[model samples]
Target chain A: MSEPILSIRHMVKRFGGLVAVNDVSLDINPGEVVALLGDNGAGKSTLIKCVSGVHLPDEGEIRFEGRPVSFPKPIDARSAGIETIYQDLALANNLDVPANIFLGREAKNRYLGGLVKTLNDKWMLGQAEQSLAALDIRFPSLTQPIESLSGGQRQAVAIARAIYWKARLMIMDEPTNNLGVPEQQKVLELIRRLRDQGVPVILITHTMPDVFAVADRIIVMHRGRKVTEKRTGETNASELVQYMVGALDDTRTSA
Target chain B: MTDSKAMAGFDEPALSAGKRAILLISRLWAWVFLALMIVFFVVAVGVFSSATFLSVRNSQNILVAIVPVLLLGLGQTFVIIAAGIDLSVGWVMSLASVLSAHAIRAAFNAGVPLFLSVVLGFVAGVGGAALVGLVNGLIIAKLKVPAFIVTLGTSFIVRGMSLLFSENTTVIGLPEGIRDYGNESLFYWVRGEGGGFYILDKPEVSGELLRSMDRILAWPVVITAVVVLVCLFLLKRTQFGRHTYAIGGNMQAALRTGIPVDRHIIKLYMLSASTAGVAGVLSTLRFTAGSAVIGDPLLLSSIAAVIIGGVSLFGGAGSIIGTVIGALIIAVLTTGLVMLNVPAFWQFIVVGAVVIIAVLIDQSRDLILGRRGRGT
Candidate 1:
């Protein structure tokens, strides 16, 4: 790997002494899909939250582009080129596709910036159309609100938002949860597209097929600690499952 | 491109024509209903009452009378769109009116100039109401109290305050200059000697048939129009309006997305109360009196106008123009009934019935459109 985009060392997070993430370390490389595999309460979410700025780690060091960094809030993480697509999608159903995509960071009119500034709807609509088109995602209309869209379309819009914002590192938590079979396939394709475009992705999932399909490497966390890490090319699905349940003692396996 | 097209085909299934029609109709239903009501009134009033039922003077009066209701409705629209309601608007208006009235009286008694006293009175009145709005916003945003309950409780307390200050007596006989300012006509239409009408001309050519033409734009009408236009611009063109809708649509989604939800909501309540204060100032100017009970009747009617205007009680789906039409409908209904010699008691019944019918239509439209329970 030329240089890892993000590196974490000795990360620790706790909730009232629960120790959700204890002494975890990981590295994510450019164009890499890292599948964070773990059972519920295995601290997979806590570790990701720490990186995404949802929770401040009790103790740890996080580096981006080989520089130490801290994200005090979600916005800080977002401004640092990190985007998270939570399981709920965090979309306003009442707002249209373009509006939801530009909810927080809206594009303002060039001449009409600040104090009296108004939204540049035309610019935003065009950008949204282009972004969705880039991802091969089509909606009935850009003006169609998220609530009116199908499940697959909603997911596509969410992913398009992350891509349109030029996210260097994207964290997707259960992106396929509650989606139908075809919708799940679309999300999987989206992840592959991201990787092909040289963007790094952190996918948290319990589904083995998803991990084997897109992940270049798998990191299994158990009981608030990273128990094993493996290269997908070297390990089979059965062996990854054994590591996940702690049946195997190997902490690291090279392809 | 070809691969993307194939994927698009798999992702976006086309909506059937039946579904399209339902969507279109559900969206335009409010406009259609409002248009139909106006048409029905025009025809019925023309046939049953005097031809002057559609006269300009009557229309101007309706416009003037609906100003306060329209202002209240506009503010309520914002609050409701943010998934909240302002039950204290009417009482706030009343309190503001009393405050300004006292300020004006004190100034005049203290030997101040009429013009300066009027200006100072307005400032005091609006400022007092703005303070009340701040309190309301702080309590609701910080305490996390449900808006419906908080505003309801505040309504009674504010009403009592207004009564206590005014001593339950109407302050009448305001300065003639202020009264004139309120009653000033933007312009008027006078009929010619042979019966041809003149536009915005003084009533120089007097005749039995000569009367003020329809569309006599009054000062109050002008003020209402300006206020409405400003609010429309705010709601449609500004980020504040978008944030209001987002917060109303789904507060959790808004908060998670980094929107300052509490602060935005506080500002919305303040806007609602401030508008109410403006209405109070206008009321004092028009009535030339301050009474604690003046705003009582406005409370229910303004809410009714908002509902009739197609602003969903569910929030995040309404417009200022819709509320304007809704206010007009109420004013027209009341005026038409009076012209038809309908009893005051019967007018109340009719207005109440119309409000209930509007809500029923809204519900049926949602059910037929197959979008029930989809607001969030």
Candidate 2:
């Protein structure tokens, strides 16, 4: 009933002659997880890329918090309170957890009337500890580089980064792809926590059970086109598979 | 609650005390290597020769020998940590040396003040090398040329430019004050004419007034120390340093975080060239002349020091202190070999072997840490 946090209308993104995302439109409301389901190369990634500022849409508009917005770079979208955690995790593996948490925007202590500035590492480490703890995530050592952490812990760090930055909308691309079973469950739990915090999440995933378990709405895309949109309770995995494979289409018109 | 336990299960157990000790030792392996080398040299020199290698004079000699390589390694540390290399650094230093020598000579001939002429020479030297670094950065960052290729090509070009600029000869005829400034000591312990030891600010060079004087710290060493301290601060305490590691660690991640990757790369190369410039000027000051080929043999030594210091060639992890130890290792090996009357050719063979050993140790440490990191 309330206004959607992000609205995409008639979005189109093309790579050369290939239309990767074709006239796809979706709305994400606050406190809800929208599972963007699709097969490999099925425009789901491209659609989210448009909103996340990875690719500019060739057609259509994106509105965030009721204002028409265009992000020229990923940083712009981030500054606008939309954080995208790429499938690769977007972490500097050589750096510690706190450094990853405050990658670009680091806290600093300035001396000599701001002439000399050093990273306020103590402050950042404390804040990172609090944020991770808030999400019930614990690390044996916060100073260990991200590469030493397990896959699930890296995901927690990424999610904590989004939360620390106060992102209103979280976009995760295949967050559970390379994770183990337990790690996958941890990530899904984190998604639920994001939703509970009133941050809308657009989850691009291929896992059916993940969609069923956490997503409130499911939008299935096939061949760069949206096939169906359904409430999680309304659609079973079999029905979603039919829509995903283009066997069922709610938007297609019979010729 | 169950998920939290699952997460805990995924983490590798806290390192055992023995393993933690190994980790600490491995992390400080470069320093340990340096200390071990000094002990070996002291014992070897004492047993095989009449001189003591551990004396203050020999230590000063080692530190002085470390200056050029350490300066170059300091810059290489940044580049290597950023997953880049600057082959042009040696030649860039040569070019700066020639330029500064010429500028100083010309300024002195033009009746410029001694202090201003020295400053002018420094500006000319650092500015010239920095320009080369800028070009190197732009081509590598913007045109996407590989850093190794770009620096190699620039190295050849700068080598030719230095020879051309200096007319294929060492520039000489520097003012007398320049040599004095270069050799001056911060403190001098003098056996004075009154049969008493006195600490003087300036060494009384006259034979009548001074029996023997021990120079506590020379200007070159002081200058090098100041440069080291500043670089230490820059690399450890600043955002620029954090971004340098991030860029090297995962450049894509750095870009996604909105870091100015290209700009930072450009600055990094410039910083590297600037250090080389400093080394060049110091060499000119030490010798009171600048030769186009002075930095020629130092290229490999500087890189050897960097790798020996535990800086991963793959980038994203290294420290300035490690590079300093690495430099000391090289300097000590060279000086100790000479003290033992070893054939000069053996120095190269031994250093080359040490480099291989250092890299092997580094790789093994990574394997150990990496295996543990995977929670296996």
Candidate 3:
């Protein structure tokens, strides 16, 4: 097999007296969907937060594209081609669709040889329309603010933003949560599309059906430790539940 | 199955004609209200009083009155849209006024050229206010202190500094040229002695000239217009304006998207203070003196204009044009009240009522539109 795209070695994170993520390691390869499953307080979010630069790891090295990397902030991680779709969507809800698509990285028209620059609204709007069209998403009006859009449309905008910036690795934290049944299906389709386009996705979710549907490999965490890792075909829902509940453990000495 | 059926038709429907009309009206409500107020005053003053409220002279008076309030509102527009407030703006203006007066006087007394002294005054005034803005920005942005507390504290500090600097007295003795520049009209159309028309430029302001001055647009009015146009362009066409809305709309989203949030906040405060500085210099020029108390009462009026203009106090959604109409509304209301021989205190009560009315209209607009149909 080809080399892994992202490799975490003995990752450790602490919140004062609590070891939120304890000495866990994992590898993700290109063009694959990896579902990170965990119960409440299982440190799933904490681990991803470290890679996305929301939190710095106390101990561990993150290698992206075969080079050791450290992200001082979310922007640094994004600049290095890591885009994270946070649970809250990380969108400026008061802004219009095109504006959100190019929020921090706005396109500009320069005058006086770049001394004066204005937002290239027309260009951004056209590009946003094309990208959404590429994703087979439709909006009644692109000029309306994000708050006016449906939850599914907002999710589509976020995914389009990552794609527009050419993100190498997409991290989605519960993208289908709080969405309607159809919206959930739409988001899953987008994830499969991302995988098809050779952009690896790390999907953190609690939905067992979602894991089986889209994830090629499932990694379960229990009590801040990796309890088991299995291919989609090798694991059943009931067996995976045992690992999630700590009834089974591959890393345990007795087991 | 029902959910899937509904999902297939989930695309938002187009706004109906009636809904579109409501959206347009709500968006332009400030301008509509300003027009209505003007017409009401014109009719009331004509019916109940001997004076006309719609004359060119009265209109000029209203425009002149709008200068300071509009300037203050202009800066406040940016701050409010960025989900911040700078209470220090009023005293910042006073401080700028005092500093400029001192700078101009000192330069003139030292035999500096009159023109250069005036320029120095401009520098000192705007620069001083900008420094206060810098301090305000640093404390609020870096320390993560609430804007209300920081600006309120700075307002007191600035007010005290102004009084201390001016020695609790007005700074006077500016060169006569400054006042002349302030009063000069861009075009003066005087009725000629023989009933012909004579248009003069930079005509001297005298009792005789004033008597025959059929029409006049003063330099201050023109200057204010230029400033307004520039601000409108800055807030609409530039990247800075877009980022201001983003920061206010969702600061966390802005940070995650890689915006330099703190630096932008500092720049916003500075922009606000510098506009206050501009108002100060204009005030000093108009009166040929600077008092630490000039901007004391204007702060609330400026904020009132912004709110009345329909810029949401919640931030991220407002316009320069709205604030302009808001200022006009207040000025017209005050001028009309005075014309009707209302008590001086009535102006405050009336303005407060108008502010409440404006907010209520905004809220009603939102309710009427509902969540799915709100406009930008």
Q: What is every candidate's C-alpha DockQ against the true complex, given to 2 decimals? A: 0.46, 0.45, 0.45
For each candidate in the order shown, give its overall lDDT on alpha carbons. 0.81, 0.87, 0.87
lDDT of 2 by residue, B81-100 (tens): 99999999999999999999
What are the per-residue Cα lDDT tens digits for candidate 1 across B240-294? Answer: 8888888878787788778888888888988898888878877887777776777
Name the top TM-score candidate: 2
For model 2, the superposed segments whose C-alpha errors exceed 4 Å read A253-255, B1-19, B190-200, B205-212, B371-376
Instruction: For candidate 3, report its TM-score.
Output: 0.94
For residue B304, give model 2's deviation from the true position in Å. Answer: 0.6
DockQ pick, better of 1 and 2: 1
Residue-by-residue lDDT tens digits, candidate 3, A157-214? 9999999899999999999998887778778878887898899999999999899889
Clashes of 1: 1
Summing lDDT over every window of 10 consecutive residues in candidate 1 chain B, give the lowest-scoring window. Answer: B1-10
Candidate 2 residue B189 C-alpha distance from true site, Å:
3.5
Residue A22's lDDT within candidate 1 is 83
What would the TM-scores of all predictions be? 0.91, 0.95, 0.94
